[model samples]
Target: MDRKKAAILALSLLTIISTDTVAPLVKQISASYPQVSSTMVKLTITLPSLLMIFFGLIAGQLVKVISKKAILAIGLVLYSIGGIAAGWSESFPGHLILRGLVGAGTGLISPIITSLIADYYQGKERADMVGYTFAISHFAAVITPPLAAYLGAEDWRKAFIIFSIVPLVFLFTMIFLPGTARRVQSDAAEKRKAPIPTKAIQFALIALVMMIIFFIVITDLPYLIETKTGISPIVSAFGLSTCTLGATIAGLTFSQIYVRLKKWAIPTSLLACGLGFLLITFSGTSVLILGGLLCIGMGIGILISLIMLVTANSAGEADSTAAVALVNGGFSIGIFISPFFYANLPRIELGLPAVEFNFLLAGVLFAAAGVIALLVAISTNKQLNLPHR
Candidate 1:
């Protein structure tokens, strides 16, 4: 691979490094911040997603004014700063501030990556690269979660602090690499060349809806399972690890399937995701929950791979980065809203209360994503005239 491809490859590691520190250190963070409620701590976890919501869109415009390479470099540096600052946060507000900055870093990298890939390659090669990129993300996912748990056991501070080094890796790779996205001639030239497609807009909406449901399930369901089923931390982490395994397998496989039928990707993934949620809502035992997670993770894997694929196809060259940024915004929105839904769910078995409604609410969103997917299907088949279903 060339220098630009090398930089693109490094983007996968950034995802792993960013979230790996959070889960294992949750207990320590809860204990350290005496003034913060568990719910408030959840907010801190959701903070990046919240920032992603706005920044994904803002990042698109930002790329217009500055080089994508510069945005990524600055974002990664800030991300390190946020991670280091949060490691020593003495107050809830301080942690929140650091998390918001970390979110900014996240907002910059992923979309820039997708856009960069679109800029660099085309035809079958583009499809293959995107698939491999997603596979790397899953590989990182598998390693990061467990390693985080181990490191947190030894020293949680090191967990967050260690990730600060990842940006250095991304920055180094980017510096050594050549820029892939060529500068357009005039201010209006790039926009005219890469005008937003109707398909891209619809793809983004579907991406947003699917992510909203995925985060809702992942964020709220784990705690519910722990408290309701009396599962130990090790067991809980292992089970969630299974989700990563499923996601990994699917990420690699879907890239091939998507290449054969580019237009149908979003709707197909959405239907699968909706079914996964139904499985989760009704899942009563630990085994059932694990199965549901597997299905859900598989769906998510497919969705991520396809969304980027669709973005590349629809966006003009210059605007492609912005389109990817918009998809990132959708991702952030999902995380941001999952908690809001998580909070409102009826409490589980409070001695006086009935069964928990968290998964049930999550089920509704998952199923709703399916509805959105079907609508997208109708619009796609009719507007694009490609028989998306």
Candidate 2:
């Protein structure tokens, strides 16, 4: 509500842009480094994701030892350096390592974004702030991919330069974020005793599933368009931007949606995801694919916000950061695994050129996940409504 909180939220959104910065450059990087296989090129996108899987949890634990602000400062430094150096690196191996550093840096900051909000805000304000963060993330996505594509069109290295601005974001955060670090003392008995809630665990699992479903589309969309439709990266950028637009809409309207749907919010989101994937899988042209991707983005937009809200609300304040870290880590794991799943799986004999069998499978999986989420929502609703004997 105040300048400080607003600053933290804005700075936190900067971190969101980092996650997808390299996506548009994937094709160019692959072309630039022909020595590596396509799969290895894809790893450039997922490698940082893999590090986030471990570092997210490590960050949670590290918060007990160091200030979240300090960790974030360090992360921004790594992120800026990695992003800047990546543009200059000639060796493929060196580029990969820089990518990993960027991921590690992101891992440190990602968990704290929501946790800081949870720590600072409460009740309706907390929920609204959470939605705002998702909206900010989507808005950043809308800007970032297209810009990366434009720059990458000239030279893939140009895309990495965008990451250098992150240090400016760090400066703003240091100046504006309030100094309120929680340091747990060495006395075991006096330590914070909050337990991770069951709902948080469930949300973490849901985050994992949703992330896999969401990122498969993200990681594959550009390549799929280039390989199938013979479109340029700019066109692919537009399609992805359309998807982010859908997410932006969802993020902006999340409060109304959450108020209306309540406990069914996540299930409704999951259904949207399923529908989106279906549209994408069966789409005949890039326009139709954009439509499908929009649907997918809307689902993810709502799902991600709701999951963060649930995870943050479930934990007591003492454990909020750790709870967030666990969920982030789960999402990271999903991100790490998505590329591999698509790469290694044998193509289906679906007679459809340019249509991946994996997309079809992904559609089915999303639909099934939606159904399961719906059933679980109903069951949980019933349990909550039951009278005491």
Name the candidate that leads on lDDT: 2
Candidate 2 — which residues are off by over 4 angstroms?
181-195, 227-235, 346-348, 353-355, 375-389
Instruction: Give residue 144's lDDT in candidate 2 (0 to 100).
Output: 85
Separate clash counts for every candidate:
1, 0
Q: Write the per-residue lDDT of candidate 2 for residues 50-72, one digit (tens) a residue.
A: 88877888887877777888888
- Most accurate candidate by TM-score: 2
Q: Local error of candidate 1 at 60, Å?
A: 1.8
Candidate 2's displacement at residue 71, Å, is: 1.5
